[model samples]
Target: MKKYFLIIVIFVVISLLGFSIIPKNPFYNINWSIMSALIIGLAMLAFFWNFEKQGVSSKEVALIATMTTLAAVSRVPFAIIMSFQPMTFIVMITGYVFGVQTGFMVGALAALVSNFFLGQGPWTPWQMFCWGMAGVISALLGNKKKEFAFTKFIILAACWGFIHGWTMNLWHWVSFVFPLTLKTFLATYIASFPFDTLHSLGNVIFSLLFGKTFYTILQRFKNKIIVVPLDNNADIV
Candidate 1:
């Protein structure tokens, strides 16, 4: 519990400080946001490796892959709308149902795989980070609860939408704009508000309409696929 809280705090602090420092630092010639994003993404990958590598079953891996694929494909329909994507909805639900590691993998893989079609660039890592964080955070928030409520899910999704947009805006500010400032950040956020709102609303609507159904399906699948080996002594002779 404390470990998770510490990780979240460290990540948020690093991200905020990185955005503030990267633009002015003379040592960083290229886009600093990308560098920071890469570091953050790598750290998350490492965390997943260390924590889940030994215990994760084949069924869990398949489940993560399937969720990632669904999240990636779900972006296609909303491509025309700019920021609206069902990816968030899928990710939130997956995280809520599964554990943190599964959520992180689904979110990160969804970003990586989807970019093949959406055109990968510096923004890819940032997208991966934001979506991945969204899942991780959602899972953490729901850790104590047995069943998550629809309203809470919608609220969380909406909050993540803004967070996602703000994190994404960091790249553009660092790469295109010079000398990052609060004014510039505000401007970027203001410009992006509508799209972010769309994202939030999309998440809310998707979760509201399909949340229960998806939860049922995934819960059933989880139950059906899980395998527990019997103790050697329990075997009938």
Candidate 2:
């Protein structure tokens, strides 16, 4: 509950800051990028704190780091492809196997880390938020069961491709597009349609080909982490 509330607060704060609600603030005028990064970083820290409160073990922390690295590195090989990468799918699978908090962390970290190579700007936080939501949504849909229906997740991945694009579009629109009218909004989205479609297709392809394998592998590790050994000296009741 606290985590979900914090997520909402993060979104609201970012949205407000982006729109310049504080009017003519000198610090915001000087360096909005740093400000945005700082806010998003703190938000990530809040989630990390939640993980600590839940008593996340060293093994789980290592697993999360491993998955985050995988998701980030996977973007490099496909950098030339416009809006087509397996990172989103990988993040979703991680979230699906691990749970919401872990998923969000992986997704957010992937965007942040990958941007080191891809180049970061004001867009970094938006990417983090969008990808993080992808993980959260996937975890919500598939984390409860030991087995998941692939078709459902495939469809979800496809849809999230557009959702991710549209959310980013909203950032672009709000930040750059003038007048904030319906026509400009539609124009912005229309211009991005092709790239968004490719992203959607890429997600579908990845999900179809590798979703189950990734899920199974991660789930196996997750199960191992959950296991507890009995004391040999203890007698049976």
Q: What lDDT tens digits, residue by residue, belong to model 2 across residues 154-213?
A: 999999999999988977886777777999999999999999999999999999889878
TM-score per candidate, chains pooled: 0.82, 0.81
Position 58, candidate 1: lDDT: 80
Candidate whose lDDT is highest: 2
Candidate 2 local Cα displacement, residue 192, angstroms: 0.8
Q: Which stretches of candidate 2 lie over 4 Å from their true place?
A: 1-46, 229-237
For model 2, the local distance difference test gives 0.84
TM value for model 1: 0.82
Local distance difference test, per candidate?
0.79, 0.84
RMSD (Cα, Å) for all candidates, in order, is 4.6, 4.3
